[model samples]
Target: MTKFLLRWIASAASIYITAALFENVYITGFDAAMLAAVILGIANMIVKPIIVLFTLPINIVTLGLFTLVINGFVLKITAGLVSGFMINGLFTAILASVVLSIVHVVLSGILGVKKD
Candidate 1:
């Protein structure tokens, strides 16, 4: 439970940092970043798998690169659901998702938040 909270905070920080790194990805404040992180977590946990399953053929064709697009789609869904967390366009969302993944990894490692 404690680790989960720590990871959640780290994920929020990653979202904030990712937003800072990209002009098109706009997070109004840390509060918005936090909300966006939770929404993103939910989207990834539920929506991503369904989308991935539906796009498996394309994913195979792209050698798994389509996963990036799916990630972006999830981010877009998050933005739609969370106010003050806005992504300007699909392309920007895709790019932001990549950066977000890198930031999340680095932040998780720095915070010693291990995946279970």
Candidate 2:
């Protein structure tokens, strides 16, 4: 429970940092970042798997590199769901996703939050 909350906060911070790094990825405020984090988490949990499954052949062909595109799509879906979180284009989303992934990993490590 405590770890979950810590991880959630870390995720929010990661979102905020990622938004700060990308011009086209806009997060209105910390509140927006928090909301986007939640939506992103849900989207990754639900939508991402379905997308990965559907794109399995291409993913295989790309040696799993296509997962980055799927991550971008998930980020776009998250932006669409959150009111104050906006990603301008698929290209920006892809770039932002890469940054977000790095930020999340670093934050998770710092928070000692083990992936489940």
Candidate 3:
């Protein structure tokens, strides 16, 4: 549970940084970013698994490139569900995914994945 929260915070930071670097993605404020992070966590928990299962063949075919799409979709969903957070377009979402992927990789390596 603690690890999950930490990862969500890291994800929120990554999203905030990515949006700062890119024009199309934006969160209204620091509190908005916090809200967006929790929304993103919830969306990922609910939607990501279904997407992965549905896209398993594509994931296999692309050798996991489709995971990026999944990440972007989750980000987009968070933006749509959260009023103060917005992702302007798919391209911005993809760029954000790139940012998030880097953050996720680094954090996962340092903190490790949850086995259970």
Candidate 4:
């Protein structure tokens, strides 16, 4: 539970970074960014597994690259759920997803999660 919260915060940090660094992404405020993170965490927790299972066949066929699409979907969903998060385009969402992946990896690395 605690670990999950930490990862969620890290994910939001990455989101905030993308908003700060990238022109296309827009977050209204830091609070909005944090809320977006929590929303994303919930979506990943409750929604992503179902999506992964539903897409399992293609995932295997694509060697798991479908996950990028899934991740972007999650971000898109997050945007709709929260008022402050506005992902301008598919490309921006994709870029945000990459930033998210990097942040998750780095934090997970520091926390000593074994990488696959």
Candidate 5:
């Protein structure tokens, strides 16, 4: 439970940081950012794997780069689901996804949260 909460907070912080870095990615407030993080985590867990599995051939053809697109798609979905979270374009979403991924990784490492 503690680990889950820690991860949630990490995701929130990642979203906050990513929004701060990108002009096209807009997070209304800290609370909205937190909600967006939670929604993104859920979307990643539930929808991402399915999308990846279906897009496996494309992913392989792209030498795994298409996985980034999948991540962006999920991030866009998250933005749509969260009222205050707005992503301006597909390109921006992809860029924001990359930033979020880096922030999440760095935060997890700094927080001593082991990857599953």
Candidate 6:
């Protein structure tokens, strides 16, 4: 469970960084950020896959670009679920999702967490 905790911490850091860099991505504080990260991760793992599966044809039609929209939807849902985590708008959520994805990837690499 050490790796899981490490990844969770990395995700929280990514959320914090994304909030810092984007005006529309608002994280109230460190505790909020951590909770948001967990909520986002759970949403991504559960809701995101179902959404992506349903939107697969559209995803293929859009040459995989719709995945970003799926990610944004998950982020928006996360914001709605978490009281202190707020995304100003859909567009901002999309941008923040993209940034978060990048940050997560970098953190995973740095932390030596293999992507499977």
- Per-candidate Cα lDDT values, in order, are 0.92, 0.93, 0.80, 0.82, 0.92, 0.90
- TM-score top scorer: 1
lDDT of 6 by residue, 6-85 (tens): 88888998998999999888888989978998898889889999999999999999999999998998999999999889
Model 5: per-residue lDDT, tens digit, 1-116? Answer: 88888888899999999999999999889899899988887998999999999999999999999988999999999999999999999989998899899999999999988778
lDDT of 1 by residue, 1-116 (tens): 88888888998998899989998888889999888888899999999999999999999999999999999999999999999999999999999999989999999999898897
What tens digits encode model 4's per-residue C-alpha lDDT throughout 1-116?
76666665666777887788878788988789889988888998999999999999999999999988888888888998999888888777877888877877886677755423
- Which lDDT value does model 4 have at 93? 85
Candidate with more favorable, higher lDDT: 4 or 5: 5
* Per-residue lDDT of 34 in model 6: 89
Compared to the true structure, candidate 1 yields what TM-score? 0.97
* Model 5: lowest-lDDT 10 consecutive positions: 1-10
Overall local distance difference test of candidate 3: 0.80
Predict model 4's lDDT versus the native: 0.82
Report the Cα lDDT for residue 67, model 1.
97
Clashes of 6: 0
Candidates 1 and 6 compared by TM-score, better number:
1
Which residue pairs clash in candidate 1? none
TM-score of each: 0.97, 0.96, 0.79, 0.80, 0.94, 0.93
- Among residues 3 or more apart in sequence or in different chains, the pairs in candidate 2 whose N, CA or C atoms overlap within 3 Å are none
Best first by lDDT, ranked:
2, 1, 5, 6, 4, 3
Q: Pick the candidate with the highest lDDT.
A: 2
Error of 3 at 9 (Å): 3.7
Deviating ranges (above 4 Å) for candidate 1:
none
Candidate 3 error regions (>4 Å): 1-8, 104-116
Error of 1 at 99 (Å): 0.6
Task: Name the runs in model 2 displaced over 4 angstroms.
Answer: none
Q: How close is candidate 2 to the true structure, as a TM-score?
A: 0.96
Query: What is candidate 5's CA lDDT for residue 111?
Result: 92
Q: Is candidate 3 or candidate 4 better by TM-score?
A: 4
